[model samples]
Target: MAGLDDITNKAKEFLDSGAVKDALSSEQAEGVSDKLLDGVADAAKKVSGGKFDEQIEGARDAADKKVGNE
Candidate 1:
């Protein structure tokens, strides 16, 4: 169980690494994250037929935190 736990948190480890954080915060990364989030949000809204617009925005914000260089 412990071994599986260790393997499952690779993203945490990567986020904790200072160099990786620096790279993630770079200008190029910023643009990429914006495009990625926007594209996903647009697609999702279309799929939902624009019914959950507010919730979709909230989800976009949450997802941005994960992949964005904040």
Candidate 2:
């Protein structure tokens, strides 16, 4: 059985392996994330009577910026 430090090291290695970054950069992944965010934003807008439009747009812009940086 792996000790706590051994498990932590393996987890760190996996995270640093770039698999996650590659997946996030894929077109299919982008499409799925975009659709998910859109659905959430639409629901938020409806719940807020459209008052949260600006907030939703801001959140989308921030997310896009982060994705672009990645």
Candidate 3:
């Protein structure tokens, strides 16, 4: 199993490289976010494991709610 420290370090590497920020600025970001959500949901449909679907849905819903959408 991956250690928490290892995982965090890897995440930090991505952020430090500015790839994360670049992704946020790109036109592909929306589609990437949507696909990330779907991937999470799909992962959640299987036996328990780390999944992003719920997080993705929550983020989407939060953004929509913030924008005053139904």
Worst 10 residues of 1 by lDDT: 61-70
Worst lDDT run of 10 residues, candidate 2, spans: 61-70
How well is each residue in 1-70 modelled by candidate 2, as lDDT tens digits? 4698899998889867788767767777777777777788888889999988999978976775544222
Instruction: Name the runs in model 2 displaced over 4 angstroms.
Output: 1-16, 67-70
Give a tens-digit lDDT track for model 1, residues 1-70.
Answer: 9888887688789779998878777877878998988998999999999999999899888877766466
- TM-scores of the candidates are 0.73, 0.66, 0.38
Which candidate number would show the highest lDDT if scored against the true structure? 1
Q: Could you tell me how far off, in angstroms, the CA of residue 6 lies in candidate 1 after the best superposition?
A: 2.3
Deviation in angstroms for 41 in model 2? 0.5
Question: Taking the tens digit of each residue's C-alpha lDDT, what string does model 3 give over 2-57?
Answer: 69989999888987676666656566665665566557555664544545556755
lDDT of each: 0.84, 0.76, 0.60
Flag the better candidate by TM-score, 1 or 3: 1
Candidate 1 — which residues are off by over 4 angstroms? 65-70
Ranking by lDDT: 1, 2, 3
